[model samples]
Target: MRLSEFSVPDTLAARGALALAEQYQSEAITAHALRSWVWAEAFALVDGITGIDHELLYVAAVLHDIGTVTEFDNHTLSYEHAGGHVAIALAAGAGWESERRERALEVIVRHNWPRVDPAIDAEGYLLEIATGLDISGARPDALPREFVRDVLDAYPRGALAAEFGACVVDQAERKPDTAARRLVDGGVLEKLAANPLEAR
Candidate 1:
């Protein structure tokens, strides 16, 4: 399915999450978050992934990179875990039950790790794939031609590559013992301008 077939969640929690992201993050980050959601939905359609709670997935997608924002940055743990806590707080404020909030937290934290298992946690897996596809140039061939054109037309990669690369590199430099540092050390953001999954 195309991105046009999907709709963002309209709940207060969803709206607040987006608003909070916009309030704290740069334009590039906000755009990347939205694009990640579209990519997740696109992959789910193409790969036949199922049994997802779209609203919860929406929350996870939008807030996945929140730790990159200055306000959420925690020096001790990886940014993934820090952002997961921020998401959990938002979920709690929204009156999410204990179980649902925990699951959402799991999805948020898992996005930082590689090799997500869809069978065990579909939202996390899809979010991980989608974020990787958008930020690291992973699996561009999985997207349909028309779909790629449509998503870029809507979100516009613009300066996201440069912006995101800087964010990752900065995090790695500031927080030495974190996953972002590992990704940087491994050259994940070395090709700054070349990594984003643009339409061919």
Candidate 2:
């Protein structure tokens, strides 16, 4: 799809995603510098996911962290608390339907670690994996082997899921620290260990 097709018109989330992506690409920002950038990259992988409204997922991913800009000191809690307000404002500003707005808000709120429900299964799964991938940075040690295994087992043949996983691995490998590299390398090794029945 054309990038513009994914755009949420006149919304801060949309603008912020683009700006953060550009900043990262230019090396003008550290991974830490662009909290939204990491969120958007993870979101883009969600965009590549199928069996869902890619637009809605993309929009929700972008807006998920809007609360971070204001109350970054406790981002996770802040995001959980403030996500609805930010989502409501942005959705209304963008003229989104109430259903769509609510769905997006739900995704944003549940995007936290150790996700809350399996009912919104796909979105929740994506959010957990995406959040793990983003926080892990170019190399994430935070995600344990069991978590990766659980996610993989749950979505074994999903193309979008595999793509997202691969992106996390690849990005992690590109970091400067040997520790980060080791984490990525080790994570893959651990994944293989956990799922010996599966092919690499």
Candidate 3:
């Protein structure tokens, strides 16, 4: 999973989804989403996890945060659920079959709640772990240091803590009892402040 060779899907659905994501999200959020794909792919290689559809994960990674953006934000459900629907719709419009589209939705939704079982859904599990690594700075030792450095070089995580904190605070206001609220109440800011990546 070399960052040098990493590329977003070139298909219409992928392009459209990315365009929407870039339109709605701040630069930091968009960069974070792109970095998620790089981190997930690198992690997969480290764990020797194979059979992944990189293209599908690319789609999932880019649109996973649509719920956090203004246009798609839903007050009732968590951002993950809201964004999952948007991802599914994007996949549907791209002519993805039901099973594949549903899998993309599952990956987006599962990313919010950590620890998706790899056996059940490897892509979802990888996305979950990848986002966790980016957001919470969890498990710094999970991947090789050189790979992490290379990724940061390619996609510098500029002010990710502040960006993610703001997003979570918004979610806390829109929907309580969700993961965002837990993260806010659980001192995620302090955690973000303590992120080792920020030290770089």
Candidate 4:
């Protein structure tokens, strides 16, 4: 959450997404618009995620066009490749530990597409969940039953464990949709193409 821990470029990317989100909120962006903004913001945030080298993951999430941007019907493959490219680029930039960068790339590669490694840790799991959540575009009040179903389907076995799962569910149930919306604005998409993650 803290920007101090991230690299300059990472920080800039996050700030750019934030500005876009704010713009969308003010304009009362529609659900589709908000979904786009959310994906961009989520990508920026994922880029700087702590305890995980998220540069590649962020790129994957940002470019995870589920029939939105690219022509590919299988967004899973698209996201994997996009993330892989980002990882390669970031590695070339020499901003992260080589081993960590490799692992990050691996995580992105396995995120949705079928791979030998299906297991994911907390950060990766969270990224997957967040990615699905953003694409689903489930508003607080309008959370389709299918949204929950899909989340459950994706994470059939609760990694949070029973007690933790209960707590997460409880919190989610109590938290208003508006609160989640406030986390990121609805206008993020339009500005994402232009904004920089950090302020120059």
Clashing pairs in 1: none
Order of quality (TM-score): 1, 3, 2, 4
lDDT of 3 by residue, 50-117 (tens): 99987789889988887888889887888988888888898899898999988888899889774788
- In model 4, residue pairs whose N, Cα or C atoms come closer than 3 Å (at least 3 residues apart or on different chains), thus clashing, are 12-197, 12-198, 13-197, 13-198, 24-187
What TM-score number comes out for model 2? Answer: 0.44
Pull out the clashing pairs in model 3: none
Q: Rate the local accuracy (lDDT) of all candidates.
A: 0.84, 0.45, 0.84, 0.36
Q: Which of the two, 3 or 4, has more TM-score?
A: 3
Clashes of each: 0, 1, 0, 5
Q: Candidate 3: TM-score?
A: 0.93
The sequence of per-residue lDDT tens digits that candidate 2 reaches over residues 1-200 is 22223334455545644454333222221222133323333444544544655455555555554443333213223433354566566666767788877877677666654544444545655654564454433224333445434434533422323433443354345432422244355564445334332332
Q: Is candidate 3 or candidate 4 better by lDDT?
A: 3
Score every model by TM-score: 0.94, 0.44, 0.93, 0.35
lDDT of 4 by residue, 1-200 (tens): 32223332354333333343233222222222223323333434544434543444443333322212223223233334443454445454555567755655555444433223224443355344443343333222223344334433432322212222232233234343421222223332322222221111
Candidate number with the higher TM-score (2 or 4)? 2
Q: Provide the lDDT at 137 for model 2.
A: 35
